[model samples]
Target: MQIIIVGCGKVGSTLAEQLSREDNDVTVLDINGQRVEQLVNELDIMGYIGSGISFDTLMEAGVKKADLLIAVTGSDELNLMCCLIAKKAGDCLTIARVRNPEYSRETEFLKKELGLAMVINPELTAAGEAARVLRLPTAISVEVFAKGKVEVLKFRIKPDSPLCRMEIQEIGPKLKSDILVCVVERGGEIIIPNGTFVLQERDNVYVAGAQKKRRNFLSVSASAPDR
Candidate 1:
């Protein structure tokens, strides 16, 4: 994948580094010569120091042949303009970051006029994830899949928990429920085990099952320690 990223701030540099690490051909653009030079020194990427909204600047950054174009400039207007121009120049998947709460709101006018594939509000997404974790502190993390029909639950076993000594066969049947533990992380190793695998203390367990049975499974297995 060839990716063109505009804006070389902390987030932009980090994104470029990660994409480059994944072996994607990445090009980054920023108006600051220092920023472009620093990113060039830090990561294996092609970089251009110019305004993202300029056609010549973006073309030099290889936007015309880009598979993905991400514009995350500080101003919402600049980001929008970058996306629009990138979209018009070529058939690239475009993503724009909009900070203003009002500009991000979807309306008939926006959906019709703006060729925006997606708009991201980083602050809102982070806040929502934080709120979910705060409420479900018992679970190390949570991810919903299968259109919300299934939930992937992660929680670590405590030293004193009796279930640590049990095997999957014993635990699944004994619970009098349908949830099954799918993955286990112990000593920094992850395992996809069968019924024969025995769980141990301090192992982070990931369970996947129907969402309807999730509460019952968590209530019997593990809990978050009070702060």
Candidate 2:
């Protein structure tokens, strides 16, 4: 896909580098010439040095032919304006980062009018992630998808747990509920397990299933012995 990104900050530059590495045609725009030079040297993407809200700059970045346009400048106004211009001028899929609390609340209304595909709130996203960890410290992480009905649950085996040395197949017969442990993490590698997989102490498990089934599944772990 051809993508154009506005701003050259840490997040924007990182996004550019990843897209470029995937062999996507990418172009990055920034107001500062020095930042543009830095992006050119650090990423394989083309760099345009000018205000992203300007038509000339966006045109030079090849926004007209872009499949995606992302505006992530520090200024909310700049991001919104760039997205609006990209939609009006290029009809591309546009995503803008707007941190103002008010804009976030009215995303539905604004998205319809502005032709925006998404609005990202980095702080709010981080806060929600932290809250999930606080609720399930025994699990390294949790992710909900399929409109919050399907879930991905991560758990670490305590060295002293009775099932620490058991094979994955033994859990179905030993446990009272239904849950599928889809992946395992040993050291830093992620493993897709088969029936022969044996879980060791400190092994991280990634389970996926329906939300209610998965919630009840976690209750059987050593962390919930009192339940």
Candidate 3:
């Protein structure tokens, strides 16, 4: 895929690097000449030094032939304008990084009016993640899937915990909850554990299940007496 990224800051440069590594043709555009040069030197991807909202600059960056355009400039309005222009000029799929909370609420409206494929707000996403972690304090990370009906949680096994040295097969019978252990990370290695797999202390465990079952499992696990 051919992708054009606007801005040379952390997010834009990181996306460029990752997309380039994935064998995608990536072109980075920014008004800062030095930043564009640095990224070009480091990543060997195409770089354009100009305002992203300008038609001439975008045309020079081959926006007409690009498959996707991502605008992640510091200014939300500028990013939106870039996407708007990209949509008009190339009719390509466009993504914008809009950080302002006020604009976040109007995401659907903006997408409808401006023809944006996606609007990403990093701060809002981080806040949601923090809230999820706060709700489940024992979890290192919590990811919701299937529109909140399912969840994948990561947590470490504490020493002397009931889960320590327990076989995966015993969890359903002992805890009386249905949860699937998806991955276990221990000693710098990752394992897809089977029912017979025994969990050791300090192992990072990832489990996935329906929301109600996961909640029940966590509640039971948290209330279990250390053995």
Candidate 4:
């Protein structure tokens, strides 16, 4: 995909590098000449020095031929303007990073009004994920899907925990809970465990199931007395 990214701060440069690595033709625009030059040399992608809201700069960055344009400028308003112009000029899919909490609440309105393909609020997303993890403190990390009806959790096995030396097949019967053990990370190696696979101490286990069921399983398993 031919991609144009506006802004050269940490997020913009990192996005350029990753997209370029994925074989996308990425062109970045930033008013900072040093930033533009540095990313151009480091990532071997095109860079333009100009304001992203300028139509001339968008054209110079090949926005007309771009498959996608991502605007992540420091200012929410500037990012929105860049996407608006890119959509008008290129008719390409557009994404904008809108961080201001006030603007964040009107994401749907902004997307509909601006013809945006996506409105990315990184701060809001990070906060939501952090809240999910905090809600399930027993898990090392937590990811929710299906509107929080389902969840995937990762937790490490400690020596005295009931799950430390348990077999995958025993969890449902022993713990009286139904959950899918998806992946296990043990000693720097990843394993897709089978029914008979035994879990060991320090192994990082990933489980997925209905949110309530998974939460119950974690609570019951966590209640086992330490030896």
Clash count for each candidate, listed in order shown: 0, 0, 0, 0
What lDDT is obtained when candidate 4 is compared to the true structure?
Answer: 0.90
lDDT of 1 at 105: 66
Across 1-227, the per-residue lDDT of candidate 1 in tens digits comes to: 99998999877888999999999998999899899898988896788989989988887778778999988878888988998888888889888888787886663345357677778878877876787566556788888677445668888887766577888888767876687788998898989989989988888898877655766677777655433
lDDT for model 2 comes to 0.83
Q: Which stretches of candidate 1 lie over 4 Å from their true place?
A: 103-118, 146-149, 167-178, 186-197, 209-213, 225-227
Q: Give the Cα-based TM-score of candidate 3 against the true structure.
A: 0.82
Top candidate (TM-score) = 4
Candidate 2 weakest ten by summed lDDT:
218-227
Candidate 2 lDDT over 121-189, as tens digits, reads 888788878886666655667897775566687877877765588887888778755778888989999
Candidate that beats the other on lDDT, 2 or 3, i.e. the better one: 3
- lDDT accuracy of residue 156 in candidate 3: 82
Candidate 1 clashes between residue pairs 3 or more apart in a chain or in different chains: none
Using Cα atoms with residue i matched to residue i, what is each candidate's TM-score against the true structure? 0.78, 0.80, 0.82, 0.85
* Model 2 spans > 4 angstroms off: 165-202, 208-220, 223-227
Where is model 3 poorest over a 10-residue stretch in terms of lDDT? Answer: 218-227
